[model samples]
Target: MNIEVSTLAHSMLADLHNNNNNYGKAIPGHIPRVPPNIRNINRAAYDPKVLSIGPYHHGKPGLQAMEDHKKRYLREFLTYMPGELEKLEKLNSLIYSVRTLEEKLLSLYNQPLNIERDDFIKMIVLDGCFILRLLIKIRVRLESEADAIFEVVPLLRRDLLLLENQLPFFILEKLYELIPKPNSIQPFPTLKEMAFAYLTMKLSTDPIALNNLEAYHLLHFYDLILLPKPRDHLIFESNQNAPSTVPQASKQEEPGIKITAKKADNFLEVPFVEGKLQISCLEIKDVAIPIFRNLIAFEQCCPTAGNHLTDTRFMDLMV
Candidate 1:
C-alpha cells in the first residue's frame, strides 16, 4: 500500500508538470456543437431542417433538397464574375486555399469527421458560395426566376441561423471578396453586414460597422450586435449563502408599485420610476423560443462566450 501510494503521487506530479507546460497555448475556437445533454432535451432546436452549411450536418438525408440550390447559387456566382477563365482560376485558388486549411477547420468541431479531404473542401466551397449568393439576393431584392425556396424566404432565413448550421465566417468572407461586384458607386457591404441584415429583418436599428466586430459564427454575430456596452453597476458580487429570488410582480404590485411593458432599443433594457417598472417587450413566439434556446445553449457551453450569456441572464431578470 505504501509503495502504490508513492507511485501514484509521482505519476500525478508528472501530469501536473506536463499540463503546466501546455497551459499557455490557447485553444483555437469554441466547440461548434451543442452539449449532448442539452441537445437531449430538445434535439430539434439545434438542428437545421432545410440546409446544412458546415461539416456538422453535411450530407444528412433530410437536408438533401437544398444541395441542388447550393449548386445553382455557385453557378450563378461564377457567371456573375468577369470571364469564364477568370472564374475557373478564382475557383481553383479557393479550393487550394481551403484544402490547405482542412486540418485546422476540422479541429473547430468537437467531434471527428469521417469525410475525405477533397470532399470536405468541395462542400466548403459550395456552402460558402450558396450563403454569399443568398445574402446578395436578399440585399439587392433580386427576383428569383425559378427557385421555389424563395417563396418561403422567411423560413429559409431562420433555418440558416441554427446553431449547428454555420460555415466559418472567414471562408464566407473570402468567397465574398473573390466574387465581382455589380456596378455600384458605394463599396459593397461586408459579409457581416449582409448576414446581420438578413437575420434581423424585423429590427431597424443601424448596425455597428463590421470592421469593429469579431465573431466565430452567425450565432456569435447576433450575440455581439444585441449586446450593449457593459455598465459597471450591472455586476453584483453576491454574498448570499443560498440562491437569490425575486418577488412575483403581482405580489409586489399590491404595495403601490406597478409593472408595464414598453418597446426598447433591444432586449434587457428595463427602467423603473418611483412606483412603476417598465419592462422591455420580448416577443416570445414558439418559433423564436428554439432560436433563443440554442443561442443560450451556445453561450452556456463556451466559457469564453459567458459575458454575452451574462447579458441574457440580465434580460431574464427583467422578465
Candidate 2:
C-alpha cells in the first residue's frame, strides 16, 4: 500500500511539472484587456461610448447602433475597389484574404475569443472597411450635410481612441493594400499618409514622424502621436538624487517658478529653462480628459511601451 501511494505521488508531481513546462512555452498576446481593478476605477475612460472596433467590446449594448453603420460603410468601401467584379465577388475575395490571417490576428489579443471563425473574419472585414471609408471621407471632404456620422464625429473620434477599441494596424494596412485607388491627377496617398492626416486633423497638435514606427493598433498610434520627437541636443539632464515624487503645480508657485504658455510644435514640449516653466499652448476641450485618461491607462497596462505620458518628468510639468 505504501509503495502504491509513493508512486501515485510521484506521478502527480511529474504531471504538474509537465503542465508548467507547457504553459511556459506559450507566448503571451500583445493586446491585453485592461485589468478589472483599473477598468473599475473609470469605466468610461476604457469603455467605448459609441463604437466598438475590436472583439473586446464588439457587440456591447450601447455600441450596437454603430453596427448598422459599419455594414453600410463596408458596402460603400467596396465601391472604391479597383476590380470590375461585382460587390459580392470583391467581398468574398477580401474575406478569403482576411481568413488566411486568422491565426495571426487571433494571436494579437491577450484572451482567447469565443467567436466563430466565420464571424471573426466578418468582424475584421467590417471594422477594417469602416475605418478605411472614414479615412477616405476625411481625406476628400466628401461627406453630405445629412450624414449622421459627421454630426457625431467627436464621439466617434473618442471611441476610436479608447484602449479597448482597436483593430490591429496590420489589418487596416492589408485591407488598404487590397483596394487600389482609381487613376487621378494627384498621386494616391499611402495608408500611413491617410492615417496621419486623420490623426492630425483634430487629435494631434502637430504632425509626428511615422517613417519607421510600427503601430500595434489605433490607440497605440495615438500614443505614438503624443510622444515628443527626439531633439539633436539634450534639453537638460536631471540630478541623480532628485526626489521621486512629482510636485503639484500649486507647489511650484511657492518656489517663485512662473508657468507660462509658449507656442511650440507639439503639446508634449514642456521645457524648464532658468526656473521658468514654459509649457506649450494646449486647448483643454471635453475630449481632452478622456484622451489623457486612456493614454495614461495604456501606459500603465503596457509597461514595455514605455511611460512617455505617465513618467514623473511629464507629470511634474503637467501637474
Candidate 3:
C-alpha cells in the first residue's frame, strides 16, 4: 500500500502543479531560468561541392552512377541530422532547470547529504542522458526522412555551437570526418573519460566509498559513451539459405521475448503483444525536450517527517 499512498500523493501534487501555481508562494523570487552553456563554432569541413565534382562521386568518367548513389546516401544524412541537432540544443537548456525535475528528484537532492556535490553530479548525469537520447532520436529520423534533404542545414547552423562544445566530452570527434558538415567546425581534442575523471578530481570523499555507493547508478551510463559502436543492429537471417534482415516480424510471438507488469483497476496495463516491445509510458512533449522520461522511486521514510506508514508488504512478497 506504500505504492497506493505514493500514487495518491503524486496525483494531488500533479493536480496542484497543473491547475494552480499556488505553492510558489512558499519560496518566491527564486532563480527562474537555467540556461546551458552554448559554444559557438566556426565551420571547417570538406567542401561538398568539390567532393561532388570529384570522379569518385561527382561523375568521374565511368563511375557517374556510383558517385550519384554515394551523393544520395550522404545527402540523406545531411537532411535529418540538423533537426536532431536543434533538439540537442533545446535539451541542454532544459536539464539545467530545477522546475523540470520530478518531485521525487527534488527530494533526492534536498535530503541530509551535502546538497551541492550531489546536485552537481545529478545535473551532469541527467544532462548527459538527455543528449545521448537526442542523438538516438536523430538516428531514427534520418532513416524515415530519406527522401527529404532540404531541412538539414538550418538545424545544424542553429546548434553548431552546442554540438561543438559537447563533442570534446563525448569523444565522438572522429565522426566529424564521416559527418563532416561542409564549412563547419575544425578538428579538436576529445575529453575522453569524463565522469570518472570528474569524480576523481573532486576526491574530497573516499574513492572506495564513492565507487561502492555509485555502483548501480553508475552502471547505467558512466561508460555508455565509451561503447565501441554507438549503434547496433538487431538483425535476423531469412529463409532459402540467404541472409536477410527482417524488417517486419513474420510471426507475433516468434521473437521469443516475454515482458510482464502489474496493473491497477483503472490505470494499470499489460500492453505487449506478439512481436513488439510496446513502451506505453513514453510520451514526448514538444518543449526544450521532454521534461521527463520514465518514473523513479524513493524509500525509507521517517516518522519525524510527519508521514504515516504505507502497506508495501505485498511488493516484498513478489520477491
Tens-digit lDDT string for candidate 1 (225-317): 777656655455575344355566766588988998888766655555677888777778877777787778767655676665534544455
TM-scores, all models, native as reference: 0.80, 0.79, 0.17
Overall local distance difference test of candidate 2: 0.74
Which 10-residue span in candidate 2 carries the lowest summed lDDT?
20-29
Those runs of model 2 whose alpha carbons end farther than 4 Å from true positions after fitting are 1-29, 81-86, 143-146, 202-208, 235-258, 281-283, 312-319
Per-prediction tally of clashes: 0, 0, 7
Q: What is the lDDT of residue 235 in candidate 3?
A: 24
TM-score attained by model 2: 0.79
Query: What Cα-based lDDT does every candidate model obtain?
Result: 0.72, 0.74, 0.29
Off by over 4 Å in 3: 1-105, 108-110, 115-128, 131-135, 138-319
Kindly indicate the candidate among 1 and 2 with the higher lDDT: 2
**Model 3 TM:** 0.17
Best by lDDT: 2
Evaluated at residue 117, the lDDT of candidate 2 is: 85
In model 1, which residue pairs have backbone atoms overlapping below 3 Å?
Answer: none
